[model samples]
Target chain A: MTDRKKTTIVLLSGDYDKVMAAYIIANGAAAYDHEVTIFHTFWGLNALRKDENIQVEKGFLEKMFAKMMPRGVDKMGISKMNFAGIGPKLIKSVMKKHNALPLPQLIEMAQEQDVKLIACTMTMDLLGLQKEELLDNIEYAGVAAYLAEAEDGNVNLFI
Target chain B: MTDRKKTTIVLLSGDYDKVMAAYIIANGAAAYDHEVTIFHTFWGLNALRKDENIQVEKGFLEKMFAKMMPRGVDKMGISKMNFAGIGPKLIKSVMKKHNALPLPQLIEMAQEQDVKLIACTMTMDLLGLQKEELLDNIEYAGVAAYLAEAEDGNVNLFI
Candidate 1:
């Protein structure tokens, strides 16, 4: 392994605010020259999903889940003060007013910075999300791979 | 300062399930001889509240927050399948059937294992929680103190 400091994040929440926080920290760590990985698991995988619908075969539960869950970061709700989904819109408007980058832009910045974005394969299976539905170029991994990186990490966080 | 591995968890969600997961990880790390810390912040501060109400002065907002938040771990709602307050009770019943320890006992186990439990001073202030309203023997700290522990932590988590 290289001697560079490592930062690994396990993004477990689907909330827009939580995902933004994870990406912000990941981007910050990357800017600081730390090797960073964001292992997206469970609902966190929603952030990696492509916005456009992809016609992929799925089981009944999977299809139901796919229909219920948000397609991408832009559709996600905040953890608190969601107020029947208006909270995210309000926050986005506030963000624009303050010139802060939105979640999608933050994610793009992470990719531009070469931050490793990994979708947990096990959860993808459980959630019935296929690779075709996720953003391109991101990695697919399991908890073992996550532990391998986090065990040696200087900053390991589960967001 | 010691050679022991470190595991630091920032408990940001007050949900019963989330708090249980955080405590489980902390207890597990402590069992493995890792120096462990659980920094309870934001809604997480609710987990440290005493079951009985205390006579503490508070502003209108703080009082409103206190009234809105759960009294302690037992009163906290589950992150999912809450069903308007049935989830925690259901989970507790299931835990009993499975012989899994409940959150309060899990917290006790962590204390018994010498795992440090810290209440985030900043969030406590923002949430209007008082020292008298929390459990005895827990430390109060801020983000800087959390970072000091987590910077060198082998397994750092924000739950």
Candidate 2:
């Protein structure tokens, strides 16, 4: 418990709060006094953008979804099945409201908390993005890079 | 913006922290003053057990993995991948640490939050479970049942 070691999380999804979930978990891990690292890959890279402002849906169905559904990104953290057209937005707003850490903060906190923030090299290549496109705080590595970390122990999470 | 309705979320993952992520998201939804429902099925059913404890690694390597990886169920929420032995135990410890939300509480939360909690009847029949075996709060239905809730434009998440 008190002697807990560091934990690494590999986040694959790009949705706002799904990525934010990594932040929450990383922050929580740091809170529990574990060293935490987050690796962002594929769609997950969206949140790492320096000035990322992906638009919230404003159409009718999306609007209707917003009404009948939750209000922010914190509620929409699922990677597989998606429901409301507006789910991701709601999840985000809630995360913001809750002061749940953002990717930028998570990265910074990981630094302050000794958590690692890595961006998947393969995902970056596939997306035609350079490492510079990511937030200034990220460390770039390959799948092998993550595997090297996961190989360390039982606590690895593919978030 | 003000005209937007509350978003609804279906917390559907059965994996370790994925389930917890669902709860965190649901809790976030609740914070947003919206509705949230977590439909438990298959492996996710394990997280809802009244007597079962969440999994943690006892092996030296596992302990090491546990420390270096995500620490709890709330931290392990990710889509399925072939990561050798790291999957299940990571799921367990987290479920245990989160105090495990009961199927009933998930259901009640849905009711209170104006979210619908539906246990996949197909998964139940396939898994040899009955609605009665589930916490009393859960309602049983097939894909038709889930679709009934999903058909509306509310938020749906398959964790």
Candidate 3:
């Protein structure tokens, strides 16, 4: 018998806060007995890999960039309008101070929660990303792959 | 003199887990005498409106979707992710249990904290939205407008 609860989320942005939030949510969902999966595409792909050195920038132009763009994900240059501002920074600091898990730890938590992690084939190919670039145990998938998972009455969301 | 000890967050993602996490962190920031602000745009706009009718569907599919999505703005479609499983429904539930604020109320709290609320003009235009479409008392701006506010270096973020 198939499990009745499932959800699919495609994470396209690779900003620290966005990814971290997803990780936290996936763990919370798991506590509720929901199966989870994450599809990383475009800028979000940067986070799936283990060796990426991206840091949440805290500079003048970076600050300005955050205010106009939609914050972190928008700043990853994903062909969307930028909405950068101070609201997010405050939250990040507090989370960090309260000992929020780092990105790697968040991914680990998601995995522990049975959250499936997928890398978008199109974005990976365009970006020239190799399987070695992403962390181990991650599946490479296409739009069809994601759609198939979403087809099982599981909700699909584009984050 | 420029006021000090204010921490602001510019929330761009409407993901339920992320939004609620930001608020929990905001409450933490407030403890440190930091002011918090959450700017809503695009998908995040859904989390801000007070009169949104979040219709929950019945059956397995609806249950799955609900499990993946957050109930209100704090549990928003905030991030640009498509969580593959256990995403929406779980987020929605926890937000309700935690008594988290919707995007509108979160905005109001920021105002109460003297935090500025700015909506992105570019996102509004791209999404074919009007100022009237947003909650009242929101200051509207293009990228340039948000940049002007971000210029002040009180700490910023993109979530």
Name the top lDDT candidate.
1
Task: List where candidate 1 sits over 4 angstroms from the true fold.
Answer: A24-33, A48-74, A78-83, A86-114, A118-159, B24-33, B51-67, B79-87, B90-102, B105-114, B120-148, B154-159
Task: Give per-residue lDDT, candidate 3, residue A157.
Answer: 47
Q: What is candidate 2's local distance difference test score?
A: 0.51
Give the number of the best model, judged by TM-score.
Answer: 1
Report the lDDT of model 1 for residue A122: 94
Chain B TM-score, all predictions listed: 0.98, 0.53, 0.61
Task: Put down candidate 2 lDDT per residue, A8-70, tens digits, no spaces.
Answer: 777777555346545655665666656567787766665565554234435665344334432
lDDT of 2 by residue, B2-56 (tens): 3323333334354554565666676667667654455554445534433323353
Better model by DockQ: candidate 1 vs candidate 3: 1
For residues B61-91, what per-residue lDDT tens digits would candidate 3 score against the true structure? Answer: 2233233333345334434443743565555
Q: Residue A69 lDDT in model 3?
A: 32
CAPRI rating of model 2: incorrect
True contacts kept of each: 0.41, 0.00, 0.00
Assess candidate 1 and give its lDDT. 0.87
User: lDDT, candidate 2, residue A85?
Assistant: 36
In candidate 2, stretches whose alpha carbon ends up further than 4 angstroms from where it belongs are: A1-4, A52-85, A95-107, B1-159
TM-score of each: 0.64, 0.42, 0.43
In the range A37-155, model 3's lDDT, one tens digit per residue, is 78888767866755543344356654443333322231232222223433334333334544545556777778776788899989766655567556788888899988877666233
